[model samples]
Target: MKHYDYILVGAGLYSAVIAWHAKQAGKSCLVLERRSHIGGNIYCEEIEGINVHKYGAHIFHTSDRKVWDFVNSFVEFNRYTNSPVANYKGEIYNMPFNMNTFSRMWGISTPQEAKAIIDKQKSEITGEPKNLEEQAIALVGRDIYEKLVKGYTEKQWGRDCSELPSFIIKRLPVRFTYDNNYFNDLYQGIPIGGYNKLIDALFEGADIKTGVDFLAEKEKWMSMADKVVYTGAIDEYFEYCFGKLEYRTVRFETEVLDTDNYQGVAVVNYTDRETPYTRVIEHKHFEFGTQPKTVISKEYSTDWKEGMEPYYPVNNEKNQMLYQKYREKAQQQEKVFFGGRLGEYKYYDMDKVIASAMNGWEALHR
Candidate 1:
């Protein structure tokens, strides 16, 4: 049996960050991952010299300067602004409903013209929105709602906009500026090297055991470590005593083309109900690299079932209640501290996952 000061139950950014801190604090650590490789959800594989995100697209965007600086230590990042395109029945439009999208929709260029168009559209809706469709029309008006938001949102949730809650759509940001930058974060980019390489470097000195099931040897593993940092699904950690929480999942269909370029953009979102898939991603665009061939993947959102990979937590009231019950159970385990997206049942981006691990390490002292 192996032993260590701390046993990290994942090899993702969260576990890597925690292991880094544990090593800095003079604590021996062991990281266990069920997958053959590290980097968890952010793991990327090379195909035709292009690094394709094995999961879905993971763009690094964060407003936290500390999180940015922390990630920069392990790997240098490249300047790649996210400018996703939306396809509505073969009619492509710039994403984020920016000035360009506004002009295309209304044949107007100035901010005032765009506002007047939106105002005229909003003036027709007099009643309170009862569902997502109504709410989207109330915010961005009918034309933009029909073309851009409706189909995509429905595809993502696997439900019609009319059936979904109004709280889901809430407000659609219609920017008056010409900026196509998807997120308004201060820092946004991709790693110079693939995420897999960065994770390997971060775990160079740490004892990591991939393809090991922590649950199978739970008692033995727990006894081997001085403390436990669990990063698996919270309900599974507790054997689903309170019942499993619902989640939304995504399936990816990848294809390698012999051509130099598959699509010009990194991500092209299909915002029409006619298309079964939600988006198609060209991996090379993320790194701005030119190769002999290209790799592409079509993403489809689906309902999560047993023995399938769970992506997003169903943050509805029912799941929230179930998570709260699991959280209470977790708090009672004095020696085990839960962290990361799966462990906490929260949706976390790349930077936030790293920051969470750092914070988890600090809290161990108190």
Candidate 2:
């Protein structure tokens, strides 16, 4: 039975940022997390002197200088670029379909040669692209599309590329340069210690209650706070009166290997139907650290269900319509504020989430 000026529903990055801002303004706050720990999906655990991303692979990338300065205030970020490699069967290719990948796929050294091959491949199509398959083929040509894009996109959405929308594969930019960096962001790195440390630092002076289901005792917490910042699913917050918005969930199979440096790179995506898992991530490679053993996880994207943890919001037309309804309802609620991925039903990287929190705080203050 604690009282505070504000109540945060989730201890994820969004809630942490809001609590940080609220505390900065001299307002008392309390954070209640359903899980035993903080950091939400971005939480990291240390294994063999390395930080393992417990939920999945999360890389911090942003172009906003304000966000970079704000996050750096809490913890130092190392120079880690996301240069993920793709493994189609036994062959390895550089990610983002860069020059290295082009060389590996077509034995082409110059950009002109690669462009010529792609033009020829694109000419084979008779008309405008209709679906994900045609769109990817038009953008990157046939060979790269089949070997890299096709199976991966199919696995991610649990549907054939031809059945999916063309917008889904509008353009996966293929850089002609030798750069293997996946993201085109101004700042990209991971916290030196771990994301867990960053979360702890953000909530330094705030009151936190873990392993507490605020929904079960909603009335009590509501009475304690003047305002509520909810980071959980918007539909769930209102008890799904308009039916559930669809989501594509991810399942991870993690194992600790006996040897060090399993899978030379940090992340290797399996973009073929033969492979059940989408990608394999060796956590230590992110920091290029040395250890006697390693831990790895194979990710599988599945259809969303009620009880499962929703990973990616399925943004098809149906879900969008449903989200619009929820948004209308959210606008009518005076005391509650909804932000973050689940609350907004939008896909967001870590930095985008931080910038969003900052924006929300600024609006609240104004």
Candidate 3:
């Protein structure tokens, strides 16, 4: 067997960056990806000349300058600001509970007018919020919560708001400005061509094998490298010794439409209970592409099962406690180092994932 300095598992963002840094340091790396494609969840498929976001809409946004510069070095990013709109039973409103949303909801213009209405509605929730329903009402008001928060949240978790823990929505962002920009991050955009370009550049010097399950042949892979960088699910890596951690995954139904445009925006969140899917994403709008045809994905948020791809971690108390037990066991593995969303069991943004990889690479040397 040809030995390598690092056996980077999962060719996701974390693994790709680690491979890049390892190659830079003149170290050999062997990358293994369980998925058929290289980009992991960030994988894009070209449909009708449009790069469709295979998983869901993954808009890269972050405040850290180092992380921003690192990705930009591989591929230049476009100025694609996420100004998503919410559709509640046919009524459209600007997202992030902005001034425009309040105006459309209450037919008011001034901040004072919107504030007064919200303050009055907030009075309904007197004591400490017992559930997500009360928490949202207390934060924004009943009108916004009922119209925007209620059905959408229920669909997301497959549970009524009253049954969910208050901490799930610790704080809801309410902006008085007319801005619809979702994230307050300093930098935001997608790769100029597509995300594949960035992934290819990052893993250019590495030896990668796709469609190989690292968990299935752990010993064989472990023998190939001095140290391992595992990015798969921590629980699965440990064979679910402490019981499986909860996660919320999404199902995407992608379609190549005949028309040039569909929703007119990159993202439109269906906030109504009747709408089965949470959001509709038009891939062309992400890069401002003037393609003759468009591709769209109807995103349906579902609870994680044994076979489904885990998208978001259900960071409830129970799951976190189980993860801690796994973490304790993971610490004892001297030859292995875990990183990324599934490894750390936290919902990490794209830039944060890169930052974690950068930090992990530095720690490897130490």
The true-versus-predicted C-alpha distance at residue 91 of model 1, in Å, is 0.7
Model 1: per-residue Cα lDDT over 1-366, one tens digit each: 767989999888888888888778788899999988888888999888888899989999999999898878888999999999998898889988999998887788899998888888877778888888888888988899889998999999999999998886656778999989999999999999778877777776789888999999999899999899999999999999999998899999999989888768999999999899999999999999789888999999999998787899988888999999999999999999999999999999887887888788888888
> Candidate 3 has what TM-score?
0.99
For model 1 the TM-score comes to: 0.97
- The segments of candidate 1 whose C-alpha lies over 4 angstroms from its true place after superposition are none
Q: What is residue 79's positional error in candidate 2, in angstroms?
A: 1.0
lDDT of each: 0.89, 0.89, 0.93
* Count of clashes in candidate 2: 0
- Candidate 3 per-residue C-alpha lDDT over 50-144 given as tens digits, one digit per residue, 9 for 90 to 100: 98889898999999999999999899999999999999999999998989999999999999999999999999999999999999999999999
Question: Which numbered prediction scores highest in TM-score against the true structure?
Answer: 3
Candidate 1: how many backbone clashes?
Answer: 0
10 residues in a row with least lDDT, candidate 1: 196-205
Give the TM-score (vs. native) of candidate 2.
Answer: 0.98
Report lDDT (Cα) of residue 295, candidate 1.
Answer: 91
Best by lDDT: 3
